[model samples]
Target: MAEAASVTTTLYYYSIFTSPPDRSRTSSSSSVSVRRRNPSSLSWVLRCSTNTSFPWGCDTDSLENASALQKWLSKSGLPPQKMGIERVQVGERGLVALKNIRKGEKLLFVPPSLVISADSEWSCTEVGKVLKRNSVPDWPLLATYLISEASLMESSRWSSYISALPRQPYSLLYWTRSELDKYLVASQIRERAIERINDVAGTYNDLRLRIFSKYPHLFPLEVRLPAMDGNVALVPWADMLNHSCEVETFLDYDKSSQGVFYTTDKPYQPGEQVFISYGKKSNGELLLSYGFVPKEGTNPSDSVELSLSLNKSDKCYFEKSEALRKHGLSVSQQFPLQITGWPMELMAYAYLAVSPPDMRRNFEEMAAAASTRTTSTKDMRYPEVEEQALQFILDSCETSISKYTKFLQGIESLDLDVTSPKQINRISFLKQLAVDLCTSERRILFRTQYGKRPGPGSGRFTDGAEILRRSLRDMRNGELRALKILNGFRKLFK
Candidate 1:
């Protein structure tokens, strides 16, 4: 029996049951098996009543995917890191976990071909349209490139993800019929493409960018994984990792070895359900990238406490205050969401978009509870509102802001609290408020953390301030100097 190492995952039954072609091109026929020490009913393999690990010849659907992946790895001519797949049961569904990981550790290595360049056309819907027609030399980079390009065309209002794109795109989606008509303006495209472009644009762009960006140097332009057909594939891992936020873990990339390392990011302690984020922000970007429809907000005519949590550390250092003030979008992970509507539903869509096919059906059942019931009250029963919300999230993934506002009007009308005129009026107010808050929060927090200069006695601070003062006083003489006070504060807090 192999001991579960600090960087190992559960021994998935599939690793043993299916035999893939040689990925390393060393041998045409060879097989491996994993043995479990403690067998339980919840384990992945059913026949292994006494063995906790998968048997050598067990066959299952997951094994099929693994077998294919194994071949891709072998033929890539990369060094083996002793990684394997494993299954665990929790609540109503099964999950995959990468066994061990260390903080600030690297797991997978990808090629630059797989990395979506920031300069790609995703920044402009107009550009995205042109790229789609262009032939991509590599298919693995297709989805990511498309998404990044689409995101540049729009922004997100929902999740922390989209706002974290290299650039802050537009955030709203789901345009009004009139609004959609406006974009088609002398541009010869049809209304349907416009709608879809809008959808993909608004979907969340965060997870895709951050998870990949954090280890950008690892992945190469072309992926080399073993395929079952005795060939190798260049499938980008970014094309994989689907989007479950809960009950999920990932393989880290090793750039030196040019291979993927595995680890679990989620655990049973979090919950049994699968949670995924559309690769972008939750508001409009999510819908655009993945076509996820979020639940609409209920007009309960009552106040619901919007919950925001800060750890003890945050409160002690006034980090919470700083966050609230400095809350504009950043390029790093941990971007915040402007949740005015159904967060639960948004979470569900994200989970589904990235979840393995086996787990997606389960997500649908769990999310059904959040869906508006037809028998519910005026505040709750708004299928139309839900649809509008869904459309907005999807549209923002790839479309523009002017278009998103138009679609938001459709969502506001579904609220039943307003007529056509009121819907139009509310649209401007909501979009402005969301955008304004995003900017204000970022600025305030940034300033609060670095706003004050030290008193006269504080030499370092005094000197810096004096330099700035002197420079300003001599406006025509030279450029003013600036210090990185915020960076200093961050290090202190950490």
Candidate 2:
């Protein structure tokens, strides 16, 4: 997957009002009133009106920026291709087909000189030398380099590319801590985002104290601050393409051509928006990293990590803890619960944690073997204790589902008109994503609990158990179809 770059607020916002000429051309009558509130401080509000042509309310600026960027690319070694930029529902500016393009056609061939990579030599040798001497990693180094160049405006060689980048990237990195806490309380992504934010801030502070303050001549204060968080690259025209879960197109470096290229595997109509796959990322991941979520039931790669911990009151708690410690395993661990199935490691951990007193003697050996050996879902079964493990897993899934349900109820009660439309949409998407994960996990548990029936003609068969097992089996089979479809879609992307 191509890593999405973070936008430098200082340069990004400046570029928004300076280079985008058409932004000033919008008529007052058709403009929509937008209340722009600072994420950190709500008291600092900026009232602005945006034209309705852009669904995201920044159409004119994006169109102008795209136009300027296209002209620049045309002069900077971009091939004369039948592709152009246009406003799209998914993103502010997206590359669209200007003419009919056939399958297997070469859509874009961006020269290496135009691509902004961490490996590329910096224009400012002094600053570059400092960065290289300190062994700064690619992400922060590139982010700082971008800020330095962007601060120069027209003097910067990559000014045109910088100007085209979105002023407000929809990434979760830009979300305020308060906003994340409020809207993403029940989701796991919130915790990850908070950790990332802290890491970035810590990195920036460390550099400032160690390098920037000592060598102010080489590293200016304006450029020293960290602006990006994840692995990033600036692929001029290629960055304009939006993402699609169904698309097989991916961006890659062509060593032979010494440039970036993306080949089309499917034909596109004259006005169709060109899409590239950002990778097999789940909706939760997409929303956290890219600031958008795919439609429900569309992402096959989606899964949630459910936390499992040992029961404190269990009779064999001390024995199990000691065994887990020897194997360098914790009593509490996270397990990936996917729509198709779960990892065998999860079941192994569960079995160790919930094993009875009689089986405690073998826990050390079992834990040691389990840690080193590969176990499949079939091997997860321990007939003597299968029911207990299944019950524990079921309880965890139920608890998660209840939390998500509560969040959904809270969203329903909010006055939509008073809240930011973007916030509302994001909150709703997250709620649905959580619901989907919980539902899938619950289905798997149901299968484990009731997919099998009592042996045929067994006199012990009760009416209630028989009916319950039959109903569960039917539902389980139906849910399995969804998992099959998801796996098939993933194969295409791979």
Candidate 3:
């Protein structure tokens, strides 16, 4: 089996659209067995099954829609599958194993014609012409196309697929501004989500002013709204699968077959909800884009971004700012803190930010080198400089943690019974995500501050550094244990 790290990277490598295709193509002529459909429309029913070990709920309408879509895909040249759509506790609707499947089995073979890509030709030719001529980037263009097709409803070629889509996606884009402010005030994800929403609106406005407004007939007002949150592509039945940190399956276009295919990395049993990684996204990222968060401590790729800047009150602030500017870095810069630790660039920036006048001459060299190389907190020396830098990071992380803690406390005091269940769950996830991020970041800072060894200790002369290190270690372990306990308790409610 592929290691989880490499598998996560593979998922990303396949999902990105780097360039437009020259022409459309078709897949093999293989056929899959299709279940006979009832003439009567399936009722939109939400069934909660208590028999499953995990909480399982399904909408009959969605499953019916998925079944129709599968048949359409098969007729359109999709190869046979051993997987079928089912209700899943993790993602509402997901692809589940229909039978025992082996590793390296081909789960899906989506034809190029069915695969939505940047090069997809739009039904509205005039609008497509303008977009193509102007070279609108792939992501936004694809998003626009998806909305355009969706607006047509039953008339669309992808009507069944559209019907199968989640009516209420849990993405941050769906969160109200008030909700974002209340729950994600301290998270860096909130800023990114806001920026993305603004960008989508901006892109739509620009298109309207330049093209749609003039050719009103081609682009109707009903279809002019922005629908995309960020980079996304809709793959019919393939998208129904939820994300898993353990699975290595990934969707990618195969030039040889002229279709999109995903291979299973591990064996799966019948009735198991098979999953594909939506890349190794952080909990915040997963929530922002997909509307879900992995269990606490399970997401290995999780990280939190911290903003750092030199204090204006410092005597050498001007010098440091100038040095940072020379290296294409702003005085205020962001650094990512991962579970393992932080990058060398953070330490270099911290060192430069607090370096004295005598060390100022070396700033340019240090800044240049930092940008090109990878450094860790352990690798960073200069006790005086690093101490200040680590302290700044520690303080920032603590402040963020405090903000989340206050919000969580405020929510706990409120009458949550009055709120919608969905809203309650979203708030709960956001609070936990904030706590997890803060905990991971603090661990790194603690390690930086107290991980170093002290000289030998004598009787009645134990080194203060060793004592402090042991204390920090114990505290870190306790924090992790508390997080685990809290997570376990949360699961009980589910």
**Ranking under TM-score, best-scoring first?**
3, 2, 1
| Residue 181's lDDT in candidate 1 | 52
Best by lDDT: 2
Question: Per lDDT, what order, best first?
Answer: 2, 3, 1
Off by over 4 Å in 2: 1-61, 222-232, 325-328, 361-378, 412-494
**What is the C-alpha lDDT profile of model 2 across 281-316, one tens digit per residue?**
656666655656666567766666667788889988
Candidates in order, TM-scores: namely 0.24, 0.72, 0.72
Off by over 4 Å in 3: 1-61, 222-233, 369-380, 414-494
Error of 3 at 66 (Å): 2.3
For residues 78-166, write the lDDT of model 1, one tens digit per residue.
34422333332321112232344333444345443332332233433433343334322222133334333222222411112111111
Question: Could you give candidate 3's per-residue lDDT for residues 1-494 as a string of tens digits?
Answer: 10111111110011112111112122234221111111111101111123322211123336777777778888877777888876677666667899998988876777767777666777665566777687765555664565556545566777666556443333566566776776677677888778756655676677667766776555543222343332234466666666787864566556565556677899999999887766666666666655556666677767676677788887788877877777778888777655555555765777777777787777775565345332322344466564455556566656666665666557555436647896777566655655554455444434434443322221111122432335445656877999999999999989
Residue 366, model 3, lDDT: 54
Judge candidate 1 at residue 138 and give its lDDT: 25
Winner by lDDT between candidate 3 and candidate 1 = 3
How does candidate 2 score on lDDT? 0.57
Tell me how many clashing residue pairs each candidate has. Answer: 100, 0, 1
Cα error, residue 245 of model 2, in Å, equals 1.2
